[model samples]
Target: MTSPAELLALYDSQQRLVVPEHPPAGVTFEVTDGVMRVTGRGEGFVETTQHLGLSGGELDALIAKHRDHFAARGEAVEWKTRAHDLPADIPQRLERTGFEAQEKEAVLVGHTSDLLVARPLPAGVVIRETNDHNDIVGLSTMLSEVWNDDLSWLIEQLEAQLAAAPELTVLFVAEAEGTIVSGARIEFTPGSDFAGLWGGSTAPAWQGKGIYGALAAARAQRAQQRGVRFLQVDASPESSPILQRRGFVEITSTTPYIWSPSAPLGTQS
Candidate 1:
């Protein structure tokens, strides 16, 4: 049996590499010296996933350089600093400066082929395949409405990714009355044994409907179809229990630490 702590470590290790190789297609990164700064133009919901690898000083400078960009556009950022390889006072620094620390979540994962995805969903909820721009746009729009984040960037990235690697990725949506209620993206990480279930979200009016879970199951089913063995996600508290109920286990907690010179020093939201 795999312990949660061990699983957490595995998740942490896998996530640490997310910045290096598999950054979201919409985000852009610029490296200077030993620092890498990542910025998402329209898809800047979680800054932690966007930017990786910067010393304290480097982060401060990057924040200063991009302060106007963020402010001009009125984007809220959850700057995440990992607990490992970071300053002890990083959260304090973030708070002292300006950024707010939000709830921390554990990365959770399971065997794709082992997940029992046939959970009961609320009535009128249906999962369906999405391949065109309109369907993709609708999914993105619903997610944005749920989280209040822009989806144009996320949609653009997904479009490019789906175009390039159709075999490795599948995007799905849950709908009611022809409007999207929940959505998820399942990516079979190329050249690896793992497939990821990402961006699981449901509309506010549709909570407790199991739409998210059903969509997750659909993604896992897709993964099984592709012969992948592992399914993974960085889950918030709300979704963690859902995954756990379906056989996913908690891995290590992943805290994203962030700093910008013009704003707070360290913050995670």
Candidate 2:
């Protein structure tokens, strides 16, 4: 069994403070003072080093600067901070600077081999990899129906990602009788030992049928084939429990502090 401390250490050392190997077209990246900013996709994000030794004033200054960076582009932004990150007041500072906290997720880490064992899926449910335009659009439509949100944006994003590097992102869908019941994807960070599992939502009728776990196992199998050491998930409350039962360890917690121009200034202030 891997300790949470060791998993976190491995994650911080390899995943953080590294620039992307192949940035997609029209997407740009910048790193300064141990903070990395990704922009030019209409929605930008900020990722940081594991530790920052800034004082209160310095922290506030850093937040305001990145906040302005996105504001100038007329784009929304997300700042990802982990619970174990230093300067515990990071979230407070972000809120004070007009960022609103979104969903809280468990930082789940587990060895891929632990999940490689076979998982049985319900009859009539077939899991398959999809990158075709029509299939991608169908999968996006299915996800929007599952979440009751307009997630059409995913269509273009997924297309761009596949176009840029097919090896980095893989999308899988659970199909039943020609209808898309569930969709999910695994993302491998370039040159890293970890891969991320994202977007495993099933249709209302498809929930509780073991499809999600099957998708996870499939993704983990792919990760193992790629020589990945661990699989990571920023799991929601609903998913955290399920993943926890499957040998995944909760190393820490993370919440995205997001800011949008359409929203008010100081929404969290």
lDDT against the true structure, each candidate: 0.65, 0.86
TM-score of each: 0.72, 0.94
Instruction: Tell me the tens digit of each residue's lDDT in model 2 across 1-269.
Output: 66889888888987776666777777788998889998877688997887888867888888888898888889899999999998888998888888899999999998897677646888888999989898788888988887799989888878887888888889998899988888899999877879989888888898888888889888999998889999999999998898888889998899999988875655222
Per-residue alpha-carbon lDDT of candidate 1 for residues 3-82, written as tens digits (9 for 90 to 100):
66765555554443344344545566655543345567442333342234564765555544444355565554555555
Stretches > 4 Å off in candidate 1: 19-27, 30-36, 43-78, 120-124, 148-153, 255-269
Poorest lDDT segment (10 consecutive residues) of candidate 2: 260-269
| C-alpha lDDT (0 to 100) for residue 261 of candidate 1 | 34
lDDT of 2: 0.86
